[model samples]
Structures are given as C-alpha cells and as structure tokens.
Target: EITVKWAGSHPDNPLVKVILRPGMQMQYLTTHEPDDAQMECAIAAMQTVLAREEAEAARATDATEAIAAS
Candidate 1:
C-alpha cells in the first residue's frame, strides 16, 4: 500500500508519502533541508532490499541448476 498525506492549508501542505516494500526499487528525493538520519535510513533500506534480491536470485539459480542436472 502507498499513502501520501497532505497536512496544512491549501497553499501550504506538507506531503508525506510512505510505502513498505522491503524488496522493491525505490528512490528518495527532497527539496527541503538535508537530514543525515533520513539519508542513513534510506541507505539501510536499500541495502536490505538488495540483499534480499540477491539471496532470491541465488536460490533461483540453484534450483535451475538442480533441475538441469536432474
């Protein structure tokens, strides 16, 4: 699920978007001030997604090789 909430008046609304997908591609951008913690969180999330994807790929490769050998 994806959600983008607007908080404020019509002319000044701060939008907040959230999506939970551990193994999905994602990109983060901002026009506001720089936040170190936010960047760290993004990096960590990306690492988790990449690791999961790699593991899944390895599993599929193993299964394919086994089937071929059989």
Candidate 2:
C-alpha cells in the first residue's frame, strides 16, 4: 500500500494536505476559496493516477487471458 500526500501552502500560511491512497481517487474543493484553482489540479492528478491504474488492470487481464488460453 503506497500513500501519496500533496501539500499546498501559501507564503506565510499553514499547509493543506491531501492524501491519495494507492487505489483511491479524490477531488477537493473548498467553498471558502470560491475560485480555488487547486481543485482542478487535484482532479487532474487523480485522473492521471486512475488512468495508470486502468491501464495496468487491462494489461493484467490480458496476461491472465493469455495464460488461460495456453
């Protein structure tokens, strides 16, 4: 199980942490910061991870099928 933590902070401000698990995706947006650009960035990051996982799953499935065929 791998954990990736993304932390964002403004100058002289406290850090905000977002934890992403190996097989989970997350999107975060805050009403306090209505124009929060971080939301899109976080979503993009999760999409990239999800895409990689999907590709890996497809490869594994193909390998399994090939093994069963043989």
Candidate 3:
C-alpha cells in the first residue's frame, strides 16, 4: 500500500493525501480548510487520477486476455 500526506502552514494553503495499491494508481486530495475552491481542486485532481488508473487497468486486462488466448 502507498500513503501520502500533505500539510499546510495555514488553513488556506490546503493539504492533500494520496494512497494507492502496490501496482494500482490512486490519488486522493485533502484540505485543512473548508473552502469551496480547495475542495473543488482536490476533487478534480482525484478524478484525473482515477481516470488514468481505469485506463491502465483496462490495458492490463486486455494484455492478459491476449496472452491467455495465445
């Protein structure tokens, strides 16, 4: 497992944490502040990472199937 933590000096700075599996790609963003902007940014970042992970998983699955069929 992979874990990441971000700390900010001020409440506005925002903090983020990301965790992922051994071979999986995952991104998590966390903020100390309750501002909408900070939360929005975090969400966007997480979404981007998730999309990338999904694409990678699909590619791996396709490769595995091809190998098994051959």
Number of the predicted model whose TM-score against the real structure is largest: 1
Clash pairs, candidate 2, are: none
> Residue 18 of model 3: what lDDT?
24
Show where candidate 3 strays beyond 4 Å: 1-32
**Lowest-sum lDDT 10-residue window in model 2:** 1-10
**Clash total of candidate 1:** 0
* Residue 56 CA displacement from its true place in model 2, Å: 0.3
- In candidate 3, how many Å is residue 44 off? 0.3
Q: Rank order by TM-score, top first?
A: 1, 3, 2
Alpha-carbon local distance difference test for all models: 0.62, 0.61, 0.63
Candidate 2 residue-wise lDDT, 1-70, digit = tens: 1222223233223332223322233333323463568888888899999999999999999999999999
Ranking by lDDT: 3, 1, 2
Q: List per-candidate RMSD values in Å.
A: 11.8, 13.7, 15.0
Can you tell me which runs of candidate 2 are displaced by over 4 Å? 1-35
lDDT of 3 at 10: 34
For model 3, give the 10-residue run with minimal summed lDDT. Answer: 14-23
Angstrom error at residue 28, model 3: 23
Model 3: lDDT of residue 1:
13
